[model samples]
Target chain A: MVSITEGKPLEHTLEQLSTTREVTILSCNTCAHYCGTGGRLAMDHLAFHLNNNGVTVVGKELVTKVCIQEQLRGCNHTKTIVLMACSSGLISAKEAWPDAVIVPTNSTLGIGSYDPDTGSATLLFPFPGHETSRGARFPSLNTEAIR
Target chain B: MIMTLRRLDYHALIAFLPRDARVLVWSCNTCARLCNGFGGKEATKALCSMLAEDGLEIVGGEVLSVSCFKSVIRKRLDRADLRMMAEKATHLIPLTCRTGVEMMRNELPWLEIVEVGETVGLGYLSESRGAVLTNSIVEMLDLPDEGIPLSEVAEDLGLFLGPFER
Candidate 1:
């Protein structure tokens, strides 16, 4: 997923937002981790990313499960919410706080299978309009062979 | 660093079985799904495959979310079509997580149970390098190999499942 800031692109969207606004990053510690995003470190990294960019991040929280309604009460109302969770999770969080401007830092990817080897979640499919980049060392298939 | 914890209760349930007992396998369709443990038909299939490979006869296999509910499980057991299979089996091996395992154990105190797979917990070890680690702990099992390339496995599984939108 990508983040937009003031109509300009930034290398790390979370860092960019922290720099531009008073931000309180909220993460759903459950499924986000499964999706390879969200957690204490992601929150800290984003905070640091923002700090380096001159954005002041006031606070953060790694809710046990953001999808659970009870945990929503723990969110602090100090600044705009930069949610580090799946799209479905963001919707739930938004419902809990109608006044907060909730911005999603990650895109909602589809169900992923766990690779016993890598411990990372690879998207089951390439997103629409996104071309899979061939590795530098791999031989490129000839167009003629395709035809 | 995949973190896995084997539920001790599950081990106890399995230990109750007689040596080389014929068993039926089942799994939950809920929490196990979220935990990445075997669930649904896939879970039942995996248990059958593993048990067969280990020289155990899997008399029958089924997948149900409420297998622990006595009324439900009992009704299935009483079915005329499954009477023979149920009679031949010495135990029921539910492939559910620790929670489901406990529920089943409470309802069927005499049934044998076994849980396989590990719970995976992940976190970043360092923010400076953006290094993440997954720790998996098996309840009563040890790894024969020092390390397994989990990233490759995750990648292959993702690709095998087909392309997904981010």
Candidate 2:
């Protein structure tokens, strides 16, 4: 299974994605859900934080099985849809709506062992193409951190 | 819909099984299949063959629609043939996520249901490699009960407690 840790902070992505336009957050309910990245609560957290910060969150969706392109089709086709899922989910969103600006909020990591006894996931081998860092855009509080 | 999985160290599974105890393996084609656990009929077949080579008698196995659904598994168990196989087998192994194991365990409390894979975290697979984890899981673990004290888990599983565990 794919086990990943959050890469970039939500504030960083929001700084770019929420700049003057309304943004929608697409959360994945499958692996992204299990990883705790794009689940309902995480998506809600992002939306709430962004909305509070003057970023108009136009839409918020929880996508099931984000990796499957078929499942990701026909989602919010607004100008910008902030993807709270993995690289695959981002790609699927992009594929489905080429015109819509799909921005990924989370950084993708590889699969590893997870001990519920501990709050950490052991990501030994990482999946290639996980360099989804949009680069350090804004020095801000880590809104999406699991604290 | 949360697809997370781990490859079972057939060695570890074998080490625990009683001598000559026949086994029945179950897998799902939903999330576990994507995580590389035996989630499909093909995967179940191949795993069965491999275990058979290891001197373990695998009676039969199946790849159901979703092994995590307790109702689904209960329905499958309703079939006389499946019920007979499960009853006859000494142990039942689920080549699925932890939830899938729970599904089997919930239905068949009397049978010894071994977990073939660890329910690590939830994520999807593009290739046959690693998957992406979610932020919600970390937040969930941040809660009191979900935290892994490492040492305690190690001690409970006897891993790094007195011996190196599988």
DockQ of all predictions against the true structure, Cα-based: 0.03, 0.07
Runs of candidate 1 with Cα error greater than 4 angstroms are: A1-20, A125-147, B1-25, B28-166
Best of the candidates, DockQ: 2
Listed per model in order, the count of residue pairs whose N, CA or C atoms clash below 3 Å is 25, 21
- In candidate 1, position A129 carries an lDDT of 29
Which lDDT tens digits does candidate 1 get at residues B46-158? 65776566567788887665442345556666777566765677787766544345555665556566554333322211212121212222223222222222332334223
Model 2 lDDT tens row, A1-147: 344546366567756764566887888875566566768887787777777778788888777867665666566546888787765566546656678877787766654434333433445335445334222221113434422
lDDT winner? 2
TM-score quality measure for candidate 1 = 0.42
Q: Could you report the Cα RMSD, in angstroms, for every candidate shown?
A: 18.3, 11.7
Q: Ten consecutive residues with minimal summed lDDT in candidate 1 chain B? A: B157-166
Instruction: Give me the displacement of residue B28 in model 1, in angstroms.
Output: 4.5
Evaluate residue A117 in candidate 2 and report its C-alpha lDDT on the 0 to 100 scale. 37
